[model samples]
Target: MNTPNQEAPAQNGKRRTRLIALGVAVLVGVGLYGSYWYLHARHFEETDDAYVASDLVQITSEVAGAVTAVFVDDTQHVERGQLLVQLDDADAQVSTAAAEAELARTVRQVRAVFSQADGLKAQINERQIALRSARADLQRRQKVAADGAVSAEELQHAKDQVAQLEAALNISQESLRTTQAQIADTRIETHPQVLAAAAKVREAGLALRRTRIVAPVSGTVARRGVQIGARIAPGAALMAVVPLDRVWVDANFKEVQLAGIRIGQPVELHSDLYGKDVNYHGKIAGLGAGSGAAFALLPAQNASGNWIKIVQRVPVRIALDPKELSDHPLRVGLSMTATVDLHDGSGPLVATQLRSEPQRVTINEQRDAEVQQQIARIIADNAGHAAL
Candidate 1:
């Protein structure tokens, strides 16, 4: 009883002192946090609503054929122009051979046309000489007939021979003109018939190359929709190739957050696959023109009775460093956390200028050089001369 009476006041005083100290600590923490927000944290706009994205290049067949072999499967890494599937090349080969043969035959036929022109010129010259001789002979016979030394029948025969020779020469000249019309101002290779046939050959070669479906871009193969012995049609989807190296992050930031964002601003990103320990460096490549709901399949009608204001999100494209991407690969649709630095001076809100240079992807398998070389070989072998 004696201890309780004396210690109660002292215990209350100690508890008050502890409470003061805790209050002071709380005040200092709040001040420090406020200072951080003012000086540092406010400069950055962060969002976890982001994803790794890249172009999903769809690979399709340009020629109809049955699948003979499947070289690549889903999840397999493929290089650009790597053979992914093979069609029943039997049909393609036959078509190619036929086209080549037709090209060769056309070249030969064109060569004959050129030769015929020269032959016609020679024939015209021969006919002209014969006509001149016939006219001279007729003149001599007419002079003899005036002197009564030539018979009337013989003179008439001379006149008829001259007339027939003139008509023959006229026919040969007309034939020469017709022949020249085709070969005029053009070489055998440049002739219309040969050009048309070369086009056919190129078409066939391209189709034959298409039978061996290859990756258009280097990356992992996905959505493999073909199998061995499956007959596929032209323009039908066969597979998809995604270039992981060229991936970028699409950060969906709230509409209010977009005010501070600008293109060309530096960005810091973290992938869910690599965790927060791994960091990625990037730059704000672009901003979305519209919000997610704006481009949605079923956009909300704010004018309706059920209207409720919802914060819309706009996608900001962040282009990452290729080297970092290589070290820590990110696949399409992977989750990411992106933090954009708003410290820099504001530029355009979004990318205003369209891309000056067009993105280009060339097929290594269907090379024009190879096709041209083959066409030249065919033309030379048949035309009896080197292709011009």
Candidate 2:
């Protein structure tokens, strides 16, 4: 059997060895964590609370009609100005035709008014000559009646003829003035009546063109709710077109983590769809004005009893590179992880202003040009040789 002293010394040494090993392990763990925090974590702010976003361009009918045909379906790619839907344009066409005919008829009618005014002018000239001749005849008859060379009845007839011719001249002059007033200071094309009819034609043309719904922008179709023979009204949400090329990411980070975050800071994003293999490079576009909870439908009442402090998240918009987006498309609402590099701390926390130019612009060149062409053609067809 071993002695008590030997047994006590051996047990003490074993206990000392176990304590030293535990201390070394603790030191190693702490050192590794410290290195990680210093080398990789501090220079960036990361969050998994992020998603892809885009402007959902809702396509609706400007005019109401039954859907005659649907050219696009859900998930189909469309180009700007491409026809996506066609309404039953029977009524629009008839209205357009009527407007055109009205415009033509009005132009001719205005021309006829001008002609009538000219005819009235000629009649007035003829009446003036006749009045002069009647007056001369009355003077001659009066002189000869005093010399007993003309009868009293004949002289009276000559005097009456002069008065009648004078009255007729006055009536003709009034008629000419009235007729000239209608055609004065205006051409056939610029006449008020023709202009009014032309406006109606433009309105009808716009209505007819609106019956064919075209894509406002190049994008992918979604939420298509229209079908053949379906009656739709103006402002109805028939579908939406999402521009994948112009998508951005909205990253929500905690309030505490918002420090040092600024506009123009470089950001790296990884979508859950592509994992970490595909990286998206972007820059901070701007930060949200307020936290989500602040704008929520039902906000928290912090002043009430049993109030618990919660971290609020503010959204940060990040614009992606267009070329990258074209190569690797990201759909709206896709989950993403964003890590913003805090190395460049020179940017502003809040954008004070935006660019002078608008981010999105709409042009009506084609439709406007078509309507202008139609108006010109109608005016030309009915304007005749009349000066416009």
Candidate 3:
């Protein structure tokens, strides 16, 4: 109904609207992708290859023996100092009895040595008196011979008696010196021989105690390799104690992802086992010194004729809450996904940069008083019986 030029204006107006819509769509698309890139810049920090790990102490026999009893089976929960196994203790008992007998013999020998000192003193006094009597007799015989009452032979015999007495006195004096020297040389308190023998007794006692294998840590046992009548030796792997409370996650992060990573930063994790139903709370405890492959048995030989560049990942240790770990027990090597918010980059990249060594194990301050009391009771019991 309108002219051609008027219709052209209408078409131009419609074209402008379409171009505006297209421009708006392009801007929104660009903005969305940019936001995505910014949010996931540290995606490498959240690794799917991360795993839960903890210190696994392998229990082994310190003494060689045939296992007589296995108190714990695989997956058994044990407390520290709880007996785990018992070896054939007949041999250990025999050794302990022999050591006790040897200790008693040593005590008797020391007492005898002390008594011999007194006996030697008495013998020395007797010899001194006998020598004086012999000298007096010789003088009397000489005077009597001059007066012609005694024969010259009798005087000579008296002189000979005095000479023999002198020899006997010298021998007695030498024996006294030797006995006194021995008394001075022998020490009742920790003499070398006594120490050597005491060490043997201690060794025997330790061996006897080892016959009853005890758990070194409080945890659940796994991978048990012991059975009744099984012979074991030192350093042999018997069982493993997995302390769930001490479990931590080791996340390998790319080098680029660590630019904003800081110690004490909070972490949120979800394990595959839990399927996002459970959330774990943790903090960045530390960073590994080097890549994992660097610690492998057969490391890559980069110095060879052929070499290729590979992206290495560094391990970051994250300490989880004990409550969380206990609530949801995680086995070693369980896969997990972790996210660390790096919004606060003011914190130190390290934990205190401390030169001081961290204590691997610590005594609970709350239980110190109780532990001391128990230790005191043990000492009193031992000292009260045979303090001497």
Candidate 4:
């Protein structure tokens, strides 16, 4: 064995070798990381302050009625226009019947007014003929009176008859004018009174249809608030439907990170619901108009002296691919990690164009169409052959 001094030097040499190796390893790691960051990492920004979000379409009653049936519950999937609740429609039925009857009666009344016009026209013709005859008779009597062949009393009587016939003719003409004014410049369907009644009928019919509450979107139901026997008024919330397929991420990034972010930039998201195994690809849809704190219920008043500088975050909306969203559905409020690619920095800070897809209420149009058909049927049934 060597001396203690020799042993110490050997151990020191090994330790020095190990130290050199460790230093070289650390240097290599740093160089590799710097290269990777320069080549890849620096081109992206990441934030864990993100969440899966979607529109919570609330189902509300459009008319007041008592709930008679609840057809759906929480967590159930529903299709658009699917009936989800039913209200007792007895009152609606009564009101609709009354409206229909009123429309029919009004139609009949208008038809009578039109008939009176025809009768007035005939009366005017008759009065005109009688007036001509009397004037002719008076002229003949005046000629005879000049020759003293007819008495003055007889001539005066003939003049009085002519005057009375003329007055009758004027009255008939006035009656026809008054009658035509009521129905002028409009058809039976477009008549003022008829249109007014038809509006009431449509209102009542719409209320009746409103008694059957339907889902406005296809999604899973949540927050079911309706129950049997519950009296719900107009605009009362019944439930909410969440469309998972349309879910997107709301990534809140620090103001400093927003310098490179732009609309239409590609985003890679990892949901906490599936952890790091599953990935979602999307594009930046839009940037929020204001920071979250700016729009808070009670926004921070920086006018005070106790203000500490806190980094603000602005929400960036990311729209995911439909196929990816379908394959891996996301729920609202779920945490997510979003990484935005800044490689292609050629987009606007805000969306330049309006959304291509917009929410449309086709069901309302259908309801209105149905109401029109009903009005047409009512008018056809009541409008008579006496159209003038």
Per-residue lDDT tens digits for candidate 2, residues 267-377, read: 999999988999999999999999999999998889989998999999999999998898899999999999999988999987899676775534356777898898888
Order of the predicted models by TM-score, top scorer first: 4, 1, 2, 3
* Residue 52 displacement in candidate 1 (angstroms): 1.2
Please provide, for model 3 over 1-388, each residue's C-alpha lDDT reduced to its tens digit, 9 standing for 90 to 100. 8999889989999999999999999999988878886786543257676899988977888788888888898878898778888889898899877876665566556555556666777877888898899898888777778789998888888888888888887887887787667556655434444445555666676677777777777888999988888888877788888877779999998876777788888889999999899999999988888888898899988997788888888899998999998899998899999988777677777676663676343212323444344333433333333222
The residue-level lDDT of candidate 4 at 162 comes to 88
Q: Residue by residue across 89-144, what tens digits does model 4's lDDT show? A: 99989999999999989898998888888899999888888888998888888877
Residue 191, model 4: lDDT of 88
Model 4, TM vs. native? 0.87
Candidate 3 residue-pair clash tally = 0
Q: After superposition, how far is residue 91 of candidate 4 from its true place, in Å?
A: 1.5
Model 3 poorest ten-residue lDDT run? 359-368
Clashes of each: 0, 0, 0, 0
Segments of candidate 4 deviating more than 4 angstroms: 1-13, 137-161, 274-277, 297-312
* Model 4 steric clash pairs: none
Instruction: Point out the worst 10-residue segment of candidate 2 by lDDT.
Output: 356-365
Candidate 3 runs further than 4 Å off: 1-19, 25-45, 121-173, 183-186, 275-277, 296-310, 343-388
TM-score of each: 0.85, 0.82, 0.71, 0.87
Estimate, for each residue in 1-388, the C-alpha lDDT of model 1 and write its tens digit.
5698899999999999999999999999999999999999999999999999899999988888888899988899999878888887777788889999999999988898888888888988998898899989988988879889999999999989989988988888898889889988999889999999999898888777777778888899889988888988889898898889899999999998988888999999998898999999999999998999999999888998888899999999999999998898888999999998999956788577888887676884346668889998998889885234
Cα lDDT, model 2, residue 26: 93
What TM-score does candidate 2 reach?
A: 0.82
RMSD of each: 3.5, 4.1, 6.7, 3.0
Candidate closer to the true structure by TM-score (higher is better), 1 or 4: 4
